[model samples]
Target: MPSSSASPPPPPWLQPPFLLPGFKPELEPKIEPMNCPSGQLEPFVTRDTLLFTPPNPNTVPDEVENAFPEHLRLAHHLGASSNDHRSVISAPVVEVPAGPSDIVGSRKRKARSAEMVRASIVDTPDRLYFRGLVRRTRMTYDSLRYLLLTDDHGRGEAGLSDEITRRRKARSDLTAGALMGNRDLWLNRDSRIIGCIPGIRVGDVFFYRMELVVIGLHGLIQAGIDFVTAGRSTSGEPIATSIVVSGGYEDDDDKGAVLIYTGQGGRERNVAQQRSDQKLHGGNLALERSMNYGIEIRVIRGIKCNKSPSGMVYFYDGLYKITDCWMDLGKSGFKVYKYKLLRIKDQDEMGSEMFKLANELKQNPSGGRSVGHICLDISTGKENVPVSLFNDVDNDKDPLCFEYIAHSIFPQQTSQGAGSMGNGCDCTMNCSMGCYCALKNGGCFPYDENGTLLRGKPLIYECGTGCKCPLTCPNRVSQKGISYELEVFRSIETGWGVRSFDVIRAGTFVCEFSGITVTKQEAEQLSDDGCLVYPGKFPARWIEWGDISDASPDYVPAGFPSTPDLSFSIDVSRARNVGCYLSHCRSPNVFAQFVLFDHMPYPRVMIFAMENIPPLRELSIDYGVGDGYA
Candidate 1:
């Protein structure tokens, strides 16, 4: 039997094709830092002409006073010397109890705080492992070894050849052990040898590096150090040997470090021998350390690997320790090797906090309506219900309608809701780019032409003053009552447009669904498969609508008295459609949102409206639809 690794190339279904386009030029925004406010005053000391001299204890007060001029003489009996004779005196202090040695104690407290801060900022072993891995992969092997041995970044020629030779010998020994058994007689003398190596101790650290060579999809060659240990002979002669062949190695310089003993013992004999054995173990006594260790590999540069087709080789350089090895004889022509190591802490945990924060933000709604709550829909008076009529009656009892409304009204409340909602008007006749008004009172009426209304016209529209209305308003009261308008002349070029309105305010609605007539059985069937039935004939419609024929045998229409088995019929004029005939631009305005009437079990897709809808701009949903990221 052939090895599983020797199986034929993976099917196309297992691999996706690459569709490459030209790269988009980056748009850099210029940002300048604001300067500080002006007119800030500088700190300085005031200049004055005041000097005081303490009187000598032996001298008389009158003689001391006569030493100065009359203007500076002290005022006595008559107090007629001069107005400047008064001296400005400093305040005298009264003794108070010292409060708990504040000065020295505070200094000590600050010192302790600084020490604690330093300890908190110290790097963990895991962090060191990850940083070492990154450095090894980004630098050459010689450079890495130099950094490790000499604590420097540059490579040195000293001991380079010897190190490389030792590595080669170790590799050969490991490969030979893997292929056959250990040749050392001292270790292989017993029947329980099982291809064991002798002379290596149980606790030594060694570096191992090897290239994996895969041959004919089955054979593999691995060369690396094995185990490093401290062992002793029956005569109590201490020995420190590295099992360089298997997957470990011992450093000669690491002798007599520290030994962590865990085995049981009662009788004591040779203290000197025991001390020698302890010296052989090395390293600060870390008893029962985890079996896993660290590994680092030099980055293999200038190698290009293709992800498509067969006979491809992918190469990546990194560090990991080999935890297990197996050679299954049952699986002919194949060998399996398993390696495990501690995950690089820095790289793995970089974005974890951000992801957690985002999740929390999503769960807790902050301000107004969440973007997910809004829903927009277009309707006609015939098969489709008018917007006013749709809003007048609450379809809260219908689970589908209820969820839709909830999403439209409080989009953030539910995890699933359309991000944007608005009205669309069909305005291809009046404006080539598209008009924002709807037909009212037999005429079209226009308002501010800022294009905000025109941009959202694909969603909803209202007639402006310039509409082609046949009847004129009789009075202000009559005009107020006739606020609703009819949409006409939707353009394929303009795509699906939306009208900007301040109806419920942004983020107000959380849920909304386009309500269409469907049989109960049909809805149930759709529910089972997790699909939506949308009305309309356009191939690019967001949802597919089903007629009575698509309904099940037990189908029943909503609000109908009799159960009639009628043929399936779809309303062409009443269905709301998103026009996709226009060419797509990098930036587009109109978007779409869809509700699955049937499938509640699967993920749903939602759409949003762009800020501007260019002429012939293609409408699209960004949820893994069409060419992703294209």
Candidate 2:
């Protein structure tokens, strides 16, 4: 019995004895309890169990000893077998508090849901109010909806009814006023009015009508027309009756003024207005200027005159008598205007003999001193005897003087000089031979190479070779002869004869020769060579027959000179000298033509008949026929 047999396994709470003696147990010390509200001892309890116990020496591991609270660990013993029980252990748990934004988010979601439900229930009028607010505030539809719903509910309906009523009243008032004023406004103005009929609102139409009517009235006033009485109607109403009236006066002298009626209901009156005037007023200026001066023109004919030593003297009994000399008007065919002293009636007789001489000269070309013979009869003692005034006179010896005399009687006629071949006055001919022999034997041969007999040659065969009759021989033949009553003296040198009969009448044809020869240069050299020829040099005698040398040496052959032995005969002067003797006058009595012939001068003179002539007027020719050279 050593103490009931082995100490019953030493109590469980205690450490088993060390296997060897003298071993002591080490135990964790118990912690004291916290103060309790009831002042009772509060056992140390842990989350593992709701109980208090001793700590087991063997159950607590040595490593966990420092981490576990000494008060929280518990140990217990069961029986004598020494079984031990230990407390369970665990960590403590904690929780966080709720935030403010989360609580607000939940409340906002609930408010939006409530608002959606309210909008769905809204009527048309309420929706229109909301829409108007949106437009007015310039806000989004959602913001407008929120504002409406949140605002005082009863005020929205009352605001909408008041706005509608105000708009209606304003429009009604404007319409009534415009309708009443339209017609009066339109009738007063002058402009053409359109769109001013019935069924238009008064306020809408009144402004335009007033403007048009004002313009019309102003225009009528400017035109000086009375708009009050103008008869034209407007809008089926009388404007004067509808508007104010006034009175005005019009001038009686105004021709353009007219009266018009205006107004309505048979009560219209008249007014005067001015309008535009719409009426033109021709006469001996030229005739007055022409007759203002005293100058006059007179044309006279048949004047007769003569050249005296003093001057040209009138041979006719006319109002004007010659006191001054006569001059030519240059190349103008009309002679210069001549002035004269008035003749007394007693002096008329002094012109009678001169007048008779002029008449005689005009009646006969050869009736002047060159061709006429004159004698004076005288009584010696008591016996009536005729004194002979005639002697053998050589008129041909001074042919130039005789030619000058002929030209003086008729200024229109011309004469050739001493050496000229024209008119048979040849100064170059040998004077030793008789004029007839020189003409016949020396130069007047028929121009034949064999010396054949021709017109101006002596007819020797007819008279027998040596037996010749002076009357029958060509050399002695003459273009003049004596008559029974008078002795006719013929000239051999000049080929002129004294005859009792006149050779030419006034304006009669004189001796004419057709062939005229001219060189091209000479023909062109004359001043009026292509226009006119006045008789500057004409022969005093008209030759019937002559030799070439007895006539003009200026003569040229009729045809080309190469033609040999050609026997053509023409007055040499007619071919050369006569045309040159003629001077130029713009107005000429004679005309010329080219007469073609088989001669040295292909074109010859052919005088043309003229119209007007005066007594003792000179006969003229045209120089255009040739240069008067040949």
Candidate 3:
């Protein structure tokens, strides 16, 4: 080291923090000059007005006879007075020795205190990165002034004005001068002086500006530069993560379903309480709009253990479709909005699965081609027969003739007339205005719109031959015949049944149970043979001849003179269609609807998928079998 006569100048990093521009020199209290034998010296002083005594304990001076002037109090405090220099040379002193236990105990306490202080410091990666900037970076005082105290509010590059406010609120004795006087802002609380600036008098206005700069720099060091940065999803979409979901939903599924519970309201809540609150109150409107417009949200698990980071900060479960939203009583008795979300498969995952499924289907045992009229061997080893078989029903014998049904029932209602019913349009055979059959039936055509059905709806009528529409009309869902690739196979429990070759989405039209037209009386006679199928007749009265349709003019009952109700059954025992092999199931995959369009005396039975059916799954329908049949 160089000669000790010259004290080393303060570190370059420390000088910039003290000399920032927002500090005002006039605000600092003046250090009054006092006369000294050596020379007059101006020095820093404490605001407290306590009298300073000389080094010698034995020499007592009368207070009234030898008191120093008021201006000399600061000099005495700094121990820089000329009299203090002489007193140090002439004073006789005695040394006191500490016991071994006392010295050891004091050393132990200091070590323990240092450990405690170090443990309390925030030592995250971001914090260390910021602290490095304050300690390593060198800049001129003037240049650093613009960076730290450009504004009076201490709103600087690091955005740390809030920390200054917090510190001021916590300590009453902390003053701006004391903060500026501190030189080591990088040290943890374990240091001799904990804060960056230290050792100045309280209520000094100049150091107040200096305090702001110190606080701004300290906050930057502790929280890091990215503390205020927003989070984003892995897909690079900006995500809103403020809303939370607790309980599961009614229809949530294991693979991809998500149900969100927007938290309770009345008091300030993290999420929206009511559905309307998503629009009117708080920042929830952004989340609500995002979900409503099909934007993916960042779902954070409410439970802390499950909140472990998956990507940036939270696990990105996946993008979801907001299928439904409703209100219900929350845990707090306030109404809350519950949103139902369906998880969308990632494009990469979906593509891989599709390719695999397609390859499996191509290598099917039946060679992936239709054998005559039947789509055979959907399940390679599952079916007893190598291929499906059926007795071909003659095309002309179908009771609901596409050529005559419309003409027979609505003799006056031509395609040219107002040809609309239900939600259907009045399109003729050409269907230039779009098929009336597809429009009227809520767009449930299997060939279009992915064949999704609106559950529990009324019967849908297809275009008839009387209409000018071509055979290619979209309305001819069932009329176009079974479009789904199906295999007929014998079931272990329920005789012969039908299964699809590929996955079928819910609401897809499966097939119609088509056969010969017959009266209810005729169907009842053949019921014992297990040949006749009743589409919609109530199970309780199916056996009673009195309840059976007597539409035949010659078959009038003894008491009934008026025409009976128009319910007819089909005789499919001989002329078997593919649907005749469909087995009955308590929890059926397919549901039958009695559809009546043109005035054929009996209603045509139509079948639709009730739920999603995977490839090679057996198709079943509810046979309307009540307790008696069970």
Q: What's the lDDT for all of these models?
A: 0.19, 0.21, 0.33
Clashes of each: 72, 26, 15
Indicate the TM-score of model 1.
0.15
Q: How high is each candidate's TM-score?
A: 0.15, 0.18, 0.32
Instruction: Please provide, for model 3 over 1-630, each residue's C-alpha lDDT reduced to its tens digit, 9 standing for 90 to 100.
Output: 011132234222122111111111111111111111123232222223212342333321111111122222211111111111111012212221222221211111000011110012244443444332321211111112222222222111222233223333222112221222122221222221112122111111111112222322121100000010111111111112222222222221233244454422233212222222212121222233334434443232211111111111111132345566565565555555455555555422222133234336535634433332333332243322233432133222222222211011222322322232333345544343235454444332312322223222334455654455666664455655566666565544555667765455445667767666666655566655755666555221111111101111122222211122335666664454566667775445567754544443344566776543544557876676652111
Tens digits of per-residue lDDT for model 2, 1-630: 001123233222223222111111112211211112233333322223312122443222111211122211211111111111100111111111112221111110000000000013145454444332222111111111111222221111111222122222222112111111111111212122121111111111111111211222111111111111111211111011111011121221111111111111111122223221100000011011111211111101111122211111211122222232222232223222222222324322323333345456434424555633433211121112121111235443322221111001111122222211122322242222233223323323221211111212111111111222233333221111111011123233323222112111111222222222233344455444322222213221111111111112232222211222212222222122122233323223333322221122232233321211222233344343333211
Best by lDDT: 3
TM-score of 3: 0.32
Compare candidates 2 and 3 on TM-score and give the better one. 3
Better of 2 and 3 by lDDT: 3
Q: Global lDDT for candidate 2?
A: 0.21
Off by over 4 Å in 1: 1-489, 492-606, 610-630
